[model samples]
Target: MKHNVILVVLDGLNYQVARHALGHLQAYCDAGRAALYRLDCELPSLSRPLYECILTGVPPIASGVVHNDVVRLSNQRSIFHYARAAGLTTAAAAYHWVSELYNRAPFEAVRDRHTDDADLPIQYGHFYYADHYPDSHLLADAEHLRLRHKPNFLLVHPMNIDDAGHKHGLDSPQYRNSARRADIILADYLQAWLEAGYQVLVTADHGMNTDRSHNGLLPEEREVPLFVLGSAFSLDAAVRPRQTELCGTVCELLGVEHDKPVCRELLK
Candidate 1:
């Protein structure tokens, strides 16, 4: 493991939508510069549960994070904890929920779900509810913070697609447009991280259905994308890795060891 990692989780995005919007994906895959995967992230596809599974390499039910209202995670074996123990700086830029779970994590968390990462206080600008959390600002601010912090283990979430799906059904123009926007921003960050000698993994927590619903066992809700770039992975490989596998993949990338039911080395 000679490289750092930047994992961009496009919350609730699908491969078709990503391919249609992020044309660069297919191009990079064709050029053998990245690996694209379609995988299932098991039940309770909600963000909180999915994130717990992704970080701990364990299923939601087993991990005890079956819902979004999970107060905090005391899992000492979490990816963030492993990264810290491995002597790598970690940062998660998204909503506050991630920080709440990894609050004890030695991370420069710059989430605006309730706290502001800027000079302005809460009275000046802050999110009071999930509904008020705009993806545009969150993604933009997160991007800047990552560039500044330059953490070896970074988890950046661009959630406008999920937000759009919630507001407008899957078939709405806004939903597709939101996916396209995510691609634009992700592409930029991907390039930046790659140029800085960091491997990048882009995936989704879950997928959305036509009815703008999830947390079910539908194909759309279960299947999500896993795109890896600037790693030791074989380019253009047909990888159907599980979502939970990403946790250990990152640990392997950072030369960190984990206990019990470790995920496989996906990129290799």
Candidate 2:
């Protein structure tokens, strides 16, 4: 049987937080393939561009999604577009507009609420808060869709940990606690999908630095995590170390041929 794919993106998450959120992410590492690599550059590691790189298997330059407001030339055409065109039911539950902005084409159903108003307290250079509506609404929506619609391509974006880390710094107890909260939420969501016999892919757009800044392409802002779990892919030693290679890697894992350009360095 063709397996359904769900991609969970934990924004601004770092390796240390993943370790702390071990209970939620460990199974993916234990039962599937996992890896860690330092990102290619420094700060201003914006989320939209980084996620576009992940979804399109190309760099920001090629993807044309460098910032939150920058629109791609192929606006309604992307990896998700390709996925849905091939008959996969695609949907997204994100906490920010960037996900919708970057992967708008593939998602038949997209739901996200903007949290960028200056009136709100800024956490980690972005407008993410621990007890924000985006977090609860997104997770609830994802759970509902997973249970009801059962989309072939489901993507989730959780912003709590990153928000906490940015507001209180990476090593603060709030960051650690937020990580745990994210873990619980993720574990519950994964368990629901697992019980339903669906394949799951967990990763992040980029890692956060101790300094709580990502304006450039520093190693911390570039390095991210990739964990694939489910009956389709096995946990083996075939994992390779590649930063900025997530887009191509995801395409390969999904058995989808990306007609568009991919980062050659990642494939190498």
Candidate 3:
């Protein structure tokens, strides 16, 4: 693979909320440099299951990561797996569950918090356990990985939006403020990443609801925002991309061969 990618999952950010709060990203969309799409995440709209779904192009029922607590390594091949198989480097600054899925299961914070094992699917990782770990710090961790390791595929998962939603509900200022904050933090490094030749995908595993909890079929829980920034994307508003399609799209962006279906319409 000759190209690189960074997938940022703004944990629990809703489509409506993102559209209103992510002004910096909206600027890219306004300038026609990015495409914003609204997509329904796979059920049951939980983080862990959808993480596997987004990375493997497989639904929860098929992947068997049907809930957040199903702690085990993914049986389905992920973007990290495909990237690694292609002899490309992979890294992530994400929730510990991500590490539990790709690197090791039953996360041991002391041993698994910082991993740099070549044998692991995510070769370089900085995994965090707390929900309030701070998005700014996570993005900084991701930037550090990008500058140091130059991974072909990097996953940046931040939990602040979800954390705010859980604490103050979706309609509260805290949730909206969190989205706004994440956007500002992203604006800080987006240009640098683009100049460095990395295609970026900003999205979420699922959305937060008014109930301050998810795992149901409500629109707020299922609907999420996808912002694609790169020359590889077509930026066509008519093309609807699925969460499951992300894995294959990323594979295509990195020139990795995979069986999963790519979002052909979304690609140039």
Candidate 3, residues 98-194, lDDT tens digits: the string is: 9999899999999999998999999999999999998989999999999999999999999999999999988999999999999999999999999
Question: lDDT per model, in order?
Answer: 0.70, 0.57, 0.93
Error of 1 at 68 (Å): 1.3
RMSD of 1: 4.9
TM-score of each: 0.85, 0.75, 0.99
lDDT of 1 by residue, 140-164 (tens): 6656656666667777776778888
RMSD of each: 4.9, 7.4, 0.8
* Least well predicted 10-residue stretch by lDDT in candidate 3: 1-10
RMSD of 3: 0.8
For model 3, which pairs clash?
Answer: none
Ranking by lDDT: 3, 1, 2
Q: Which segments of candidate 3 are over 4 A away from where they belong?
A: none
Model 2 vs truth, CA RMSD: 7.4
**After superposition, which runs of candidate 2 have C-alpha atoms over 4 Å from their true positions?**
27-44, 71-77, 99-131, 134-136, 241-245, 248-257, 260-268
Top candidate on lDDT is 3
| Model 2 / residue 161 / CA error / Å | 1.5
Better of 1 and 2 by TM-score: 1
